[model samples]
Target: MAMAQNFRSAFHGFNREDVVRYLEYLNSKHNSAINQLKSENQTLTDELKALRAQTVSNPAAEAECARLQEENQKLLQQCGDLAGQIAKLQAQMEEAQKNKPLAEEELEAYRRAEQAERAAKERARQIYCQATGALAEATTQVDEAAEDFKLLSQRIATQMTDLQSTIDRSKEALTGAAATLYGVCSADTDSQ
Candidate 1:
């Protein structure tokens, strides 16, 4: 029964974000525990190596062995720290993945903002072109052209106000998305 249960869990790959977070917590705890065990293992191995080196029959061999032992101990200590670092990196990686939803949401929101900006720009272009064309058709010396120019100028002014409003709305949405993105990123960073 226990074996079947273990096998089931092994293939139970559909964990939710919140569940994954809990799994991350458990994994971090396990890594810390294993790291402690590795430290003890390294100590014992270093002691064994030192004992082996000391049993050599030559004085020069003993000196060389002592030097080598010191170097090995330093290397082992470095490895222990690196193991802890590996755990830290693993935790960070899991965290980044967990925050992917917020990042994806920001990406989507930015995409919408980009599309809105493009539409606004297109509208502005069309308005400017219409006004310019009308003004161009009207000659400065012709009364109709002069009158059309003034009207076009007025329309342009109005369109400018519309463009400003569109820009303001876009900025507001971008700002909100930026805030949410910043919150998610900062939360992960603080936890790490």
Candidate 2:
């Protein structure tokens, strides 16, 4: 029998209802086939028993009896083959049933892993945003500090220019006082 391979997907895994329904369908078909084979085997066995009884009571129909026996043997062989097939099918079904839970567990593990990965990505994105904001704030503060330093340098340059002009005026005044004192001393000496 051909097995189904495709199943509908659900959020967590394959759709449970669809998988269960398919399994139930295959089981029903298998049971029916097994029952039919058993029924045919029983019918053949009954007929063979009846033929054997007839052969014992009536020895004149030996050729017909031999032919019937051959046909019965062939039928029995066919029934045995059918029984072997049924056994194999049952074994396969049992194996499938045994593995169902393991498959579900694996699918659950995959779902959990996917969720964790998404959470990690979200955390990384949040960190990136925070770092970018901090960088922008630091850049603004540095620009402000640089502007303040430039203004302070300009003010110090102006103060130095004013101090130099005061010093030049003081030097001229002292020179004029010295020249007047020398001229007064010379006049006094000549008059005496």
Candidate 3:
């Protein structure tokens, strides 16, 4: 830009025509510089407004972000709770596995005891059957023996009666023989 010429005397320094021309030139340059600066300022102000609009948040977006953060925290807490529950269940399963052998042993012992009891009962039943059979056989034998004794007693009684009858007949025959001999002897003596 150019500066305007100033004079203190009428004839001591620059000419009037030269001063007037220099002042006009300076005024034009100044006006052109000011217009260019104003245009640049306006462009810069527009860019700044656009930048502020991009950076600023709407109310709905801000609320949505807050809600999403709260939900994320709740999900994280639930995950931790599920992990704890899984760990507890795993420990219980391990404890049950440890006791499995003992439980099986006890079950086996009970089965053996039940089988032994059943076997003993069967043996006792067999013995009882055998004893009943023996008793029946003994009773049959005793009955047969008693029948034989009765038959023998009857046969002995019949034989004794027959023997007594034969002895009485023999005695009567001997008495008749003795009477005949005595009559003969008495006749001979009388004749002599």
Candidate 4:
């Protein structure tokens, strides 16, 4: 909207005083806006710097990752021990089957051996199940860590983009204000 002017003033389509006053007001407003923009830019820049610094020190995530790795190693070792036990039991059973004994005492011993083999197999199966659960838990922790890192990176990226956009807008606003003030000052000087 244009500023209202009393055109009935002496020899004028619009009041020169009103035009000057409006221009002064505009120049002051632009100056104030420029100062505010500079302040906001500084604040945003500081916040971004702080965020970057925080990204550098994610010690908790690192520690968690290390702990998960250790757990995985332990689970793998347990799985290996269980596999060895299973193999040994299978070998013993096969040997017993090859040496067939007909005596009652010998048959009773064979039955006991079979029972022991079954117990060993069941224990191995239980250990295998435990190892599987541990592995899955480790995998889940790793995935959560990855997701957290990704979210932090995305947050940083978004902040950087916003800061850059504010800077660009401030620059454009300053440029436009400078051009407008220059035009007004030049016109005043020329009219003199």
Candidate 5:
């Protein structure tokens, strides 16, 4: 461009009428450069607007929201089911605990009854043994009494035989005394 200015100066010294022609060529070149820059800026602006509109119209964002809502519903239902199961199990455990003491009491009652029955049976056995011992002692005393009676009967028969012999000897002595008295009486009568 400096060389073009020098050429314009030299041509101007030749004829002052060429000054308009040089100014016209420089203006045309500047105009062409400005038009190219304006067209490029307009094309970049249109691309940015198209990208903004496409982002607003997308279906992927809507599908992701629906999926999240469905997952939340499933989680809530699962939690409710678990809570119900826990409540039923707790009730069953409490019922079993309530019956435990009653069963233990019944078992203790049966044990006490058996112990009382055993004590009663032992008392009966002791009484029976005592009665049997008393009966045996009485039977032995009766047998001893029978043996003493037989010994007393034999001693009485021996005393009766000795008394009969003494009576016979006394009768002979009395007959002799009576004969002597009769002789004395006959002699006295003849003398008189």
Candidate 6:
């Protein structure tokens, strides 16, 4: 999402609360995504264990489980990368705030920092969306695989029902976060 560059400039510099709040919001949103991914990973792991416990071994099901696990790992890695980027951005903001300079150079530096933060936020959002899509696809594949096994189908159907609810909640949370961000950005624009 494109945000205006205008920030409410204070006597000494741009409003610290505005910058801090924006960063905090991004951090919260990213953290939520990370937690959701972790929960899903755990669920998949549990399901894999259950599948293995069955006496009747299906090679195709095992292969599908392995693929899902690998995808979960990749998603986790992406989340870790995003988290690292957020921390770096937060550090840069804090450092900029501490070294507040009443000069044109300082204003330029602040602008650069803001731009970097925006880029990071955009990247995080993209990653979250991608991960969500991948998860839905994976779940569908799991459902399809479950159909081949009588016992597995019942278990997966129950799990999918629960997972659907979780996905719904995640989507709601994401929407709320986006709305909060828009409101914050709008307030900043109005303040200017």
User: What lDDT tens digits, residue by residue, belong to model 3 across residues 74-114?
Assistant: 65555556556555645655655576667667768988999
Q: Which ranges of candidate 5 are over 4 A from the true structure?
A: 1-78, 142-192
Which whole-number lDDT from 0 to 100 does residue 66 have in model 6?
87
lDDT of 2 by residue, 83-174 (tens): 67667756766766787888788889998999999999999999999999999999999999999988988888887788777777777777
For candidate 2, the lDDT comes to: 0.73
| Candidate 5 lDDT (Cα, 0 to 1) | 0.56
lDDT tens digits, residue span 1-192, model 5? 652554444311422223334344444544454454345444544544454556575566446544544554554455455445545545554554575566567668877988989988998888888878877887777777777777766666566666555665555555565566666777888889
* Weakest 10 consecutive residues of candidate 2 by summed lDDT: 55-64
Residue 41, candidate 3: alpha-carbon lDDT: 51
Clashing pairs in 2: none
Q: Against the true structure, whose lDDT is highest?
A: 6
Native-vs-model 4 lDDT?
0.66
Candidate 4 clashes: the total is 0
What's the ranking of the predictions by lDDT, best on top? 6, 2, 1, 4, 3, 5
Q: Report the C-alpha displacement of residue 2, candidate 2, in angstroms.
A: 8.3
The digit string of per-residue lDDT tens for model 1 on 78-181 reads 66766676677577667767867776777689889999999999999999999998887665458876788999999999999999999999999999999999
Which 10-residue window in model 1 sums to the lowest lDDT? 2-11
RMSD of each: 39.6, 4.7, 41.9, 61.5, 44.7, 53.8
lDDT of each: 0.71, 0.73, 0.65, 0.66, 0.56, 0.82
Off-target runs (Cα >4 Å) in candidate 1 are: 1-57, 116-192
**Per-residue alpha-carbon lDDT of candidate 4 for residues 33-131, written as tens digits (9 for 90 to 100):** 555555555555555455556656676755654555565556555555655655564565454445434334565887899999999999999999999
- The TM-score, computed over Cα atoms with residue i paired to residue i, of candidate 4 is 0.31
Please give the distance, in angstroms, between residue 139's alpha carbon in candidate 2 and its true position after superposition: 1.7
In model 3, the clashing pairs are none
Best by TM-score: 2
